[model samples]
Target: MGGERGSIVHRITKRVSQEIEEDPNLVLINKKNADQADYLIGGGITSFDTYIDREKKDNRKYCTKGVFVSIRYQLVDVKTKEIVYTEERYIDRQDTREGSAPHAIAVVSDDIDMLAKQIVDITRPHEVKVTERIYLVETKNKDFKTACKLAKKSENRRKAQELFAKVYADEGSYQTGYNSAVLLFLNRDFEKAMEEMQAIEEKFHTKEAQKALKRIQEEIEYQQKPVQETSLDSMYLRF
Candidate 1:
């Protein structure tokens, strides 16, 4: 809510209402106009922060350019006062050309609007595409091919993981090793994935291997975080 004349809260509310009105199953009547409704959605921006960095030329400060906008939001049922969703999002952009502080602030405001659109997408129904890969080692061994095929299937993950491990041990193909690590990651075996990727990094040291290793390390760190309870009380108390 703490924004310029084009407030983030107003932008988000207008966009969400427009999107909901387009849905055949939903209607958006103003609170004052409607006497009663089946449900009410209510929430506001909890926090809005912006950062701008000034460019430096030969140790002398030049013009401002880079900007970052972070916002925390929540959605709640007005009748029950229960929070249905909450999230914090950040957007950043940089421009090398000389610009004033107001120019950088304007860029950040645009980014906030874009972030609001993304939040609206989350509240609406949409389809998402999932991409996956299975490595194919150049070999005549039919068992290895079968394992690769099985590994691509969601239901046979465990069996496929065991088979891929066996293939990695026998063939010692860097491709197979990478595939094995990927399978371990998909199965939530982060430690094994890290070990396999680390081995690959030591021997091959390929860019692909390094990236995968970094990704697996991040996943391991994320999994180690403690789970927290989600409730309206927490949402209201946070700000």
Candidate 2:
């Protein structure tokens, strides 16, 4: 490393190591801790993929190498026994070195580190958002048939109205807001989704609500960079 390395140098290494460690540890820990704690935990990586590009120097040229890795994961907590996390991590590793093998490794490693850190930053929050989403979905699905039946077949119209109202009025209202925000987020409407979330904060100041909203916002911002690339791909597909 040169000149004690820059701040980013440390970041790069710390990130890669952290990702490597956390990726595996989450699975083992969640499995081990599932029954013992107040919360049941489950985490696993379903898939991992990597891409690399290399340009060789002509003995007189500069070369650059880049790697991108994506990790897919799902995690659940037991007390609720609900999926609390679903997220993907994307990392980019890049190196620009003349012709040295050591320099090449250093560059690639540094890039991996940088990418891994980015992955962590993006994924952790996304996990929280997804978990909240799952909770909301579960709530909505729990009494659907009963609620619909009461709404449709109650002998007293007034009673049916009341039952229907009671059943569906606030069912997952908070989750609906959060879920709408998630769709907006996927559509790349970050600002509006955030504003929608702000209203949730104003209305329900619960810690869970706040945490859920915060997690969604963080993931939206984290994934924005990739969305740009995704947009380009979509355009190509359209053509």
Candidate 3:
């Protein structure tokens, strides 16, 4: 694969080899050595954007710089020459340096390294951590308390969301409404979460409700975006 950054092609080749070496099911070899292999992986840097402070505070001195790199990759059947998988991913890194624009751009090697690792991760997926909050029941109702316990077990998220919504509707407690919103978020219902949080904020006017509303709104915006499976051509056109 090729990239606009100096030595990026070499870095990518080295990084890919390193990643393959770490996987027990994969092996890295040259094209000539792939006669017995089942699949071939290939692709290149499809888009790149590097920038130094275009606006000069004094005599063209730059205070900020960054790079955005996008790479496209695919896995194909070596025998049939049929494409099996394709992906395009983008990485952006930026920093501030009190120096000339050229000097600022020279310190982007770390960004390139990070981009290379990201590409490797796309090829070999990595494990990520997910955080889940424990919702406490404030009501004296025995049934609501039992449902909260079931919700914490994660066996039935949809049922938990519905139960919490019912509790909030019957009790009209701000805490119950907040719990319902949290369950809605866990269920991947961003719009409903936002609605619940907004209602809580408007009625209670408390700092906690306002903060929760803000977080839910941010999650809603993130879910609405089309960043996943983006294309290099579309990214370039948008930029």
Candidate 2 residue 47 Cα shift, in angstroms, is 7.0
In model 3, where do residues sit more than 4 Å from their true spots? 1-6, 54-62, 102-239
What residue runs in model 2 are displaced by over 4 Å at the alpha carbon? 1-34, 37-62, 100-239
lDDT, each prediction? 0.59, 0.42, 0.59
Could you give candidate 2's per-residue lDDT for residues 1-239 as a string of tens digits?
23212333344444544554566433222333435433221122222323334455565554565544443433333455443334554545566656532233354554555545554443343342222332223434534334333323223223333333344356636544444444444334567767766776777676765775776677665544321111000100000
Decoy 3 TM-score against native: 0.43
Across 25-78, the per-residue lDDT of candidate 1 in tens digits comes to 556655564334434444444344444566668766655455555555555444
Descending-TM-score candidate ranking = 1, 3, 2
List candidate 1 stretches off by more than 4 Å: 1-133, 228-239
Candidate 1: C-alpha lDDT: 0.59
Give me the overall lDDT of model 3. 0.59
| Sequence-dependent TM-score of model 1 | 0.47
Distance from true location, Cα of 151 in model 3, Å: 20
